[model samples]
Target: MLTLSRRFAAVAFSALALVACGAAGDGAGTSGANPSEANADGELGHVLGQADAPLTIIEYASPTCPACKYFHDTVKPTIEEKYISTGKVKFVFREYPLNEIDVAAYAMARCAGDDKFFDVLDDLFENQEGIRYAAQNGVVKTTLGAIGQRHGIADTATFEACLSNSEIRQALADTYATSEKWGVEGTPTFIIDGVKHNFQGEYTTAEGFSKQIDAKLAELGAQ
Candidate 1:
C-alpha cells in the first residue's frame, strides 16, 4: 500500500513518463538543458540504463499506457539484462502524456527528485490499474499522498506544495515542446542513434525487442 506521499511521487513520475514522450528530440536539441545531466530538474523527461554507453536507446512513453508498462516490466528489463546492464547500450525514457491527468502524474513524480525517479516509475507501472481505479473514484489524490509517505516524503503539506507548483507545470510544457521536436505521435517509440522506430505493438515482448536490438547492433557492426 503506497502512502499519500508516495502516490504523489508516483503520479508525478507517471506524468513525466508521458511528458518524456513529448520532450525534444529534434536535431536542434532540447530546451533549458540537455537531459543527459544528473540535475535535470525533471527536464530529463525520461531515461534509463547508462548514459555514456556506445548505443543509446530512447523510449517515449505514457504512464497510463498499458503497453508502456508491459515494455517497462517485461521488455525493458530484458534489454537491460542483456544490453544495458552490460554497458553495450544505454536507454533514455521520455514522457509523452496524452492528457491533463497524465500531466498531473508527472508533477507528482518530480516532487521526489531524480534519485527516486525510476524506482517510483517501476512501482507506478506495476500498479497502474490500482491507481487508475483510485483516480476514477476520487480517492486518487489521497492515495498518492500515501505513496509519498512510504517514500519518506511523509510531509503531506510539502507533497501538495510540490504538486501545485508553477515550475512543474513549466517543466511539463518544456517536455511537450521537446516531444514535438522529436516528432512523437505515440507511446513506446524508440529512437536509436537519432533514427526513430515506432513499434507496432509487438515490440512489447522480450524476444521481439531483443530481435530488434540485434538488428540495430548488427547494423552498427558491434563497434
Candidate 2:
C-alpha cells in the first residue's frame, strides 16, 4: 500500500519544473493535452467564462482551507453571476494544495479529465468536511474514490490508478512551483491582471469584493 504521504512526496518542496501555463496536465491520463488552449493572460488552468474577458482573476486555493471553501461556495457564485457571466471577467482556479491530503484530493479532481474539472472541484468543496473526516479515519482514498466515481473516474480500480498517477502528481508539482514563482502566500489569493488583490478587512463580503472588481473594470474602461 502506498501510504498517501509517500505517494505524493515527490512534489513537496522539491523544486519541479513549471508546466508552461497551459494544458491543465502535460500528458498521461489526467487533463491530457490541448496545446492551443489558454486564457486571457495566456496562462492555463481551469477557467470559467469568456476566454478573452478583460478581467482575468487567477485564484490560488487549497482544497482543505475553510476560507477557500467560503470563497468557492459564496463569493465565486456572486462574481460569476455579475462579472463572469457578462464577459467582463475570465476566472482561473489553480490548485494550491497545502498538505499531502489536499494533494491527493486535487489529484483525483484532475484525474476526472478537463471536461469534468470544475465539477470535481465543486464536489470536493461541497463535501470538504466529509473528506476531512475520512482522512482522520484512514479512509481518505476511498472517500476520494467515491467522489471521483461521480465525475467519470469509473471504478475503484481506475480511481486508484489515476490517484497514484505519475503525470497528475508531476503536474500538481509544477503548479506548486508556478504558484511560488507568482508569489502566492496563502489560499484564496486573487490576482487580477497580473497584480495580487487582497480582499481582506472591509473587502471580505461579496458586495465588498465586487466593488473592488467593479473599480478595476472602471479603470480599464469597461468593454
Candidate 3:
C-alpha cells in the first residue's frame, strides 16, 4: 500500500525531468504526428482536440491542483464557449498529476470514463479541499467513494478497485512520461501549437484568462 506521501513523491519524481526541461526552456511544440492518427480514436490519441481545427490548445492539469481547478472551472468554460464550441479551435485536456493526491483524483476521473469524465472533473473540483484533507489522513477511499455515490456510481467496490489498480497507476505514470517529453513544469500550463504560455499573476477569472488566450491566438494569426 503506497501511502499518500509516497505516491506523491513518486509522482513528483516522475515529472522532474519535465520540470527541468521547462526550466531550461526546451519548451513544447505540436506533436506534428499527423492529425489523422490523432483523430482516429475520436481525439483520445496523441493530440487532444478537433483534428481539423486551425488552433489547438491542450490543457495539462491535475485534478487535485487548485490552480488547475480554477482554470478548468473558471477560465476554461469561457474559452470553450467562445472558441471550442464555435470550432475556431479545439481544446484538449491531458492529465498532469502533480502528487499522490492528484494520482487518486486522476484515477477517479478515469474511472468515470470518457463520457463521464467532465462530470467527475467538476465534482472533484467542487470538493478539492476536502478531498485533499482526506488523502492526507488516509481516508481517500471514504472521500472519493462519497463523491462516486453522489454521482450515482452506486458500487463503492468498483470505485475503490480503481484506486488499487496497477494498470491504472502505470497508465498515469505514462501520462507523466509524456508530460516530461513535452517539458511541462506545472499545472494550468497551456500549450498552443508548439509554444508554451505561462499565465501571469492570478488568472482565476474567465475574463483574465480569456484575454491571454485571445492575445495568444491573435499572435498565432487569427487576424
Measured against the true structure, the TM-scores of the candidates, in listed sequence, are 0.75, 0.80, 0.73
For residues 61-97, could you state the per-residue lDDT of candidate 1 as single tens digits?
Answer: 7776765776787678788889988877877776677
- lDDT, candidates in the order shown: 0.63, 0.70, 0.62
For all candidates, the clash counts are 49, 0, 2
| Number of the candidate with higher lDDT, 1 or 3 | 1
Q: Pick by lDDT: which candidate is best?
A: 2
Query: Can you write out model 3's per-residue Cα lDDT over 162-198, one digit (the tens) per residue?
Result: 7778987887777666554455676766666655554
Off by over 4 Å in 2: 5-42
- The TM-score between candidate 3 and the true structure equals 0.73
Instruction: Give every collision pair in model 2.
Output: none
- List the candidate 3 regions with Cα displacement exceeding 4 Å: 5-49, 201-205, 215-223
Candidate 1, residue 104: how far the Cα is off, in Å: 2.3
lDDT of 2: 0.70
Better of 2 and 3 by TM-score: 2
> Candidate 3 lDDT (Cα, whole model)?
0.62
